[model samples]
Target chain A: MKTRKKVKQITADGFKYAFLTIMLVFAAFPLIQVVINSFKTDADVKTMPIGLPEKWVFNNYRDAWEIGGYARAYFNSFLVGGCTIVIVLTVVGLGAYALSKLHFKMRGFFTAYFFVAISLPGFLYIVPDYFFMNKIGILDTRMSLVIVYTAMQIPFNMLLLRTFLGGIPRELEEAAKIDGCNELNSLLKITVPIAKPIFLTVALLVFVNVWNEYLWSNTFIITDELKTVATRFVKFTGEYSSNMARIYTASVISILPVVLLYFIFSNKFIEGMTSGSVKG
Target chain B: MNNNLGQTALFAIMRNKKVINNMKKTSIIPYLFILPAFIIHFCIVTLPSLSTLAMSLFEWNGIGNATFIGFGNFTEIFTEDNVVKIAIINNLKWLAIFITVPIIMGFIVAIIVSRIIKGQMFFRVVYFIPYVISAAVAGKIFTAYMNPYYGINVFLDKIGLTSLGDTLWLGNPKIALYSVAFVDNWHWWGFVMVLFLGALQQVDPVLYEAARVDGANRIRELLHVSIPGIKPTIAFVLIMTVMWSFLTFDYVYVMTNGGPANSTEILATWIYKNAFAKYRAGYANALCVLQSGICLVFYFVQRYISKKGGMEDED
Candidate 1:
């Protein structure tokens, strides 16, 4: 009986390992294949999508960089992401501080408003927003994307920052006030430094969302010259349909920044993202 | 230069005021604090969203002058448009697939990842790498990988599966939506798994211990103790999945653009087509209102269920 139990344990362990290995392959195979094939020639990829090349070729990256106009795409994406980070942090920072710390008449109403706003689908407003941008003559500009993205991010990131600030002790700011710091000064000086980690987390999250944003960027920014990395990649893939190697290579380049950031700050990414889900 | 001069002057003026005046001065400070974020969100999101109601009642091309047509656009969606029905059905299918497949896959992976002591972080990060990839990039990657000529088909052909290898994964009408959903799930389930892993780690160890003491096997413990411990997270995940499924556009837009007889056209894509491609911005707003109305109904239904279930949803 004891031997039978031991046999059952081994089988269970084996099953677990089998399942995990299958999952690992499923998650990593396509990506690993893309990476491998990016280094090979187009003929080689057509022949063997998963295999290594006979003679490794690095021409795809250089060809894709020039052909895809990746320098401009990366620059535009960085500009949009940078502007969004600065705007969202300062604007939402003050708003979150108010919502969490200060007493106002419409506090509850604003909180509920933000909650409802978060659920508002982007498609609903994006149509009219398109025309509105045209009216303002901001169409085909990256700043058009910056404004839309900052607004789309405000509600959730505001609520997120509010929740983070709620945990900080009120006594810290009060002590600063007693020592002659004003209200705005107390926020900038005392509370903000203590809440720097959450702020950085919010910044990273906003930057990722901006970088990955497609619908707004696709719709509003019509010119190829102004396309962000994500939209530029779609156009690139279409233009390079006959060359899988260049298409996949461009994709790897577009995802490199976020992926590298994820490797370095995976915890912040996971925490900032899942916190919204859990709290929702 | 460091701070706004207007704000600096307001603080400077308030500093010398009496206690009663201080209270009055401070009450408006919060409003001042919230003004910048509020103004931008209001002009961009809130105004446009509320305008959809008004925009839906008009018949105007984007560049033309507006003509008021009450209830005309709404009725036309049900009567005139053929794609709206298919798009809604496709969205429902999307909801069904997302809530079931990824949720289950994520839960099971979370369980396994949570159990492993060594290399747990490795599995977690590897699984999540796809989720970090943009939809445009992920779709292109899959577009290459699923292409009949130069992708996974090559491997299948090498292994002597000619029929499977030759299949046009995104071109076939029958499987196009599912194919797109598969690419989306490739980038989605890792997120689900991470969320579930987060919820799982918060589960009490004592409950698992008690289940073990009660002679519960692993599957039994998973179904009984582990599942129940993460019930709120599961519900939250389902709610978000419902929301996201309704709003899914990036993958389909990038991969096929709702092509091949519009087999993969979901509501968002259809709405985008009407608004942009067809130049019927007014009609698109009507469709947008309809789609958002569906989401709002589901949101309320989830809220009611959570309230009825006595789920401790503090947020």
Candidate 2:
């Protein structure tokens, strides 16, 4: 009986491994195929989809880079994304800190205000937001993108930071106060440093959100040069008749930074996100 | 002696005044820190969004004089628009898929990743890399890969499954929607996997240890230990995925642009086309209002279920 059971368990384990292998293949196949196709020339791209290129063509990368003007687009994305993160983090962090730490008169109302904002779908604001931005004479600039993104991101950012800050014991701040630090000093010196992990997570989340942003960028930004990398997809490949190899290569390059960042900071990224998720 | 005593009293009073000042200074700092965020939120999200609500009441081309058309757009959304009905059904499809596929797959993949004695990090990273790519980029890659003539279709044909190749995946209105969904699942599962993996860690190792001691096998252990351990995470994921599905515009817009005769239209993309593309801003805002209502329903449903579940667990 024991021997028979052992055989059954072994067979089951083998089946389990096989199932896992198939699933992983299913999950990863398209991405791997795309990465491989990025190296193919035009003829090879069309002729050989599943297989490797006949000749390894690096010129696709060069053409994709120059023709797409990805360098400038990347810089524009960086400027907008970076400024958005800075502005959002500072604002949300402070707001969250105030909500969590302070005993202000309107604390309950303010916190509830943010929670309500967090629940609304962003697209509901698209049309009116566009009109508002246009009215303000900032419609085609990178600043418009930054301001818009920062606003949309603030409620969630505030809530996440608030949760993280709430986890920190108030004793740390009390100790800082005893040492000659004022409230501002304590927040800057004590709270910020200790919450470094959460800070990094928020910053990275902000970076990815803004970097991958499309709807707002596509809506508010009309100028060709002002388009961020995300909007470039709609502009460059809008009609869906662009050259296959070049478009694929451009798409791959444009998403490279975000992929690289995920590889680097995924641990904190996962943790911070899960914290908010689990609690919710 | 009298003069020296007077100097000490004045010094003490000044020191007390400085302490009070410092206390006042500290109290204002958090607000100062939060002011920028509030200002931006008010300017960007709150103000524009309120105006959107107001605009839904008026009929005006973006370039024209505003005319009040109270509830006219809203009335049209529910009464005459067939596209709204199609979008609502498609939105249902998205909600169903988003709720099921990610949770089920994420659960299974999380289990596999957790059971891996080696390459856990590698598998995790590999699976998650796709989620970071902009939806546009992913859509382009899929567009090529799914091309009928020269892409996966040809490969399928060479392997004797020619029918799979020749089918116009995106060209057919019937299957184009599912094709878009396939692309979305590819991009989204990794993020779900990561979330599940984190929840998996929170599952105590001792439960598995106990199952093993009882001579339970891998499947039994997973069924008995893993599923129950991450139930909360599963519930949370279900709710979030539903919300995300309803709000999905990026993948659909980028991949199909509601193409092949609007077969792949979801609420967001439909709203975009109606508002901006067709120049029906009022009608689109009405659609937007309807979408928000849909989101609210799901939000409340999740909240109710979770609350009920929490009560049952307590008993």
Candidate 3:
């Protein structure tokens, strides 16, 4: 009986492993297929979609880079994403600090406001936002994208940072105050240094979201030169619909920065993305 | 003696005045710190959102003079617009698929992964890799792979699965939306699994051990212990899935562009087409409002259910 039970336990373990392995493949295969196909020529991909190229041709990357105008799109994405992170961090950090630490009358109101704003769908305001941008003549510019992204990101990041700040003991800031540090000095010296983890999480989250944003960027920035990586990628595929190799290559190129960043910072990426949901 | 007393009194008053001034300065500092975020959020999000309601009531072609026709756009949406009806139906279909398929897959995978000790992190990172890639890239990858001539269709054809191989996945009106949903889910479910795994880690292992002591099998333990353990997380995921379903756009837009005669037109892409492509901004604004209304309904319903559940626990 003991041996039979032991065998059953081993079988259960085997089943678990088998299930996990299958899931891992299902999750990883399509991405692997894309990466593999990106190196093959169109003819090679056409003939063998699942296998490695007979001879790896590097020109697909070059052609995709040149014809898709990915360099400009990359630069534009960086500019917009970078500026968005800076703006969101600075603005949301201050707001979060105030909400979490300060004693104010409207704090509750503002917190609820942000909660509602975060829940509201983006499309609800997108049309009016477009008109507002056009009316101000910032349409088709990187600044418009930056401004819109900054606003869209603030509500969630602020709430996340606020929760982070709330967890920190207030005694440290009080001690800083006793040591001749003013409120701003206390925040800068005592709070900011300790809140580094949350700040990094917020920054990485904002950067990824801004980099991946498509609809607003597509709508607001119509000029080809100002187009972001995502929008540019869509247009690139449309323009080169027949060339599967270049399309796959361009898709890989567009996702390379984000994917590499994600792999390198996988822990932080997972933490930030799941922070709000898990905590809630 | 009198002169000295008066001098001390004067000094005390000066100190009090300084304290008052400092209090005022500190009070204003929080406002100043919060101002930039408030101003930007208000201008870009709050103000525009408020304006959408007014815009929906007016008839204007974006550049021309605006004319107010109260509920005219809303009337047209319900009475005249066929795309709006299709969009609403498609969004509901999306909601149904998302709430079931991803949640079930995520829950099952997460439960299994939670039991594994070795290579757990490796599986997690790999699974989540697709989620990190942009929707546009995911869309493009799937589009290429679904191409009848060169993609997975070829493999399917060789495997004697000729029906699926020959079917125009994205080109077919019946399958275009589902095809896009599948691609989106491919990138999505893994993230959901990771979330569930995180929640699963918080579950009490002692309960699982107790179940084992009671001679519970794996499936029995999962149904009784693990499912109840992650109930709150499941509820949260459900609420978010509902909200996101109404807002989904990137994959459909990039893959099919609500194509095959608008068969795949979810509300978001439909709104985009009307506002940007067809130049029907007013009608599009009404559609946006309708989408938000649906989301708000879901939000309140979730809240009500959770609250009732919480009260039951108290009882």
Candidate 4:
């Protein structure tokens, strides 16, 4: 009976491994395909799409960098994403601190307001917002994307930060107050230090969102110099439709920053993303 | 005695004034902290959203003079616009697909991974890789893989799957929406699995032990113990799935541009075309409101169902 049970357990283990391996392949195959195709020449890609290239060429990257204007796109994405992150961190950090700690009459109202704001579809206001931006003369500029991204991401970041802040001991802030530190000083000196993990999480989330944002970036920033990696990709693909290697290289170039960052900080990325859904 | 009473009144008045001043200072701090977020949000989201509502009642190109034509946009959208109808249907199709496919796939994967003793984290990170990649990148990757001449089609053809290989996945209108949705789901379900896994970790282990003691097989344990344990998470995921379905624009737009005769036109993309490409700003605003209205309906419905479910659980 013992031997029989052992055999059954072995079979179960085998099945489990098989299932997981299949799922892993399913998950990783497309990305692997992208990476592989990025290295192949156009003829190699056409003939053997899913196989190792006979002659691995590196010119695609150079071509994509120069012809596709990916370097400029990358800089634009960083500038927009970086500025948006700074604004989001400041606004959301302060707002979250107040919402989590301070006693105020409109706290409940603002909390619900953000909840609704997060759910409100962006399509609802894109047209009017576009016109508004055009009238304000910020259209075709990176600042326009930064402003919109900051507003769009605030609610989620605020709520997440609030949750994190709520978990921090109240004594820390109260003790700082007793030490004669003002509210802003207490937050900057005391709360910000302790909330570093959450701040990192929020910053990463904002960076990813702004970097990967396509629709608003596509609509608002029409200038080639101002286009982000995502919008630039659309134009790049159109320009390089027949050259599969160049297209793939540009695709890889566009995604490299995000993908690299994600791999390095996968744990924090997962935690930040799942925290709101699981806990809220 | 009168002097003493007057002095006591003066002290009381001074204390009250001081208390009022302290209250004002305390109240202002929170407002000050919250003001920056509120200002940006109002300017970008709230004000523009209000204008969208107002604009829907007028017939105007975005640049030119405006004329009020009350309910005209709505009337035209419901009756005249064939694309709106297709978009609504396509969105509904997307809703149906998302509600079932990802939830089930994510749940099953979570369960399988949860039972494993090692490398669960590896599986999780791998699965979530797609979710991190931009939708545009995901779209481009699939567009390449779905290319008729040099992609999965050729492989399928080699395997004697002639019909499958012949499919113009994105070019053909009949299956274009589904193809885009498949790519979206490929990037989506792993995130779902991770979330469910997180919820699964919080489930009480004793219940699973009890099920095992009661001679419950794996399937039975899953049905009775695991399902009930993660009910709330499942419900939340479902609600979000519906909400996101209506808002899904990136994959469809990036892949097809609602093309091949508008077969893949979800509401968001349709709204984009109407507003930007066609310059039917007023009509597009109506569609936007309609999309939001559908989302609100989904939100309330989920709230009602979850409330009912909560009460049932109490019983």
Interface RMSD of each: 1.8, 2.7, 2.0, 2.0
Best by lDDT: 4
Highest TM-score among the candidates is held by which one? 4
Q: Candidate 4 local accuracy as lDDT?
A: 0.87
Q: Write the per-residue lDDT of candidate 3 for residues A1-280, one digit (tens) a residue.
A: 9999999989988999998889888888888888888899998888878878998999999999999998899999999999999999999989998898876667898888888777767888889888878888999899989998999998889889999999998768866765778878888899999999889988888889988888889899888999999899999988888888888888889988888899889999998888754211
Q: Enumerate the chain B TM-scores of all models.
A: 0.89, 0.87, 0.88, 0.89
Better of 2 and 4 by DockQ: 4
Over B205-256, each residue of candidate 4 has an lDDT whose tens digit, in order, gives: 9999999999999899988998889887787787788788888888998999
Q: What tens-digit string does per-residue lDDT give for candidate 2 at A1-280?
A: 9999999977866766677677678767777777778788877878768878888888878887887777888989999988987887777777887887766556787788887777667777888777666777888889988877888888877888898899898768866876977777888898899888787888888888888888888887888788898787556765434477787777778888887887788786666555544211
Off by over 4 Å in 4: A277-280, B1-24, B306-315
lDDT of 2 by residue, B180-278 (tens): 898888878877888888778888999989999999998898778877787776776777776777788887888788887878888899889877788
Q: Which stretches of candidate 3 lie over 4 Å from their true place?
A: A277-280, B1-25, B302-315
Residue-by-residue lDDT tens digits, candidate 3, B183-300: 9999899989999999899989899999999999989998888878877777778778888888898999989989989999989999998889887888888888998888888877
- Give me candidate 3's interface root-mean-square deviation: 2.0
**Model 4's DockQ?**
0.63
Task: Give RMSD (Å) of candidate 4 vs. truth.
Answer: 5.3
- Every candidate's DockQ is 0.62, 0.50, 0.63, 0.63
lDDT tens digits, residues B109-175, model 1?
8998888767778888888888888887888889888887778888898899999988899989999
Across A1-280, the per-residue lDDT of candidate 1 in tens digits comes to 9999999978877777788889889998888877887898988878887878766899999999999999999999999999999999999999999999887789998888888888778887898889989997998988899999999999999999999999998768867876888789999999899999999999999999989888889898888989999999989988888988888788889998999999999988888888864211
Q: Which has the higher TM-score value, candidate number 2 or candidate number 4?
A: 4
After the best TM-score superposition of candidate 4, give how far the Cα of residue A231 lies from its true spot, in angstroms. 0.6
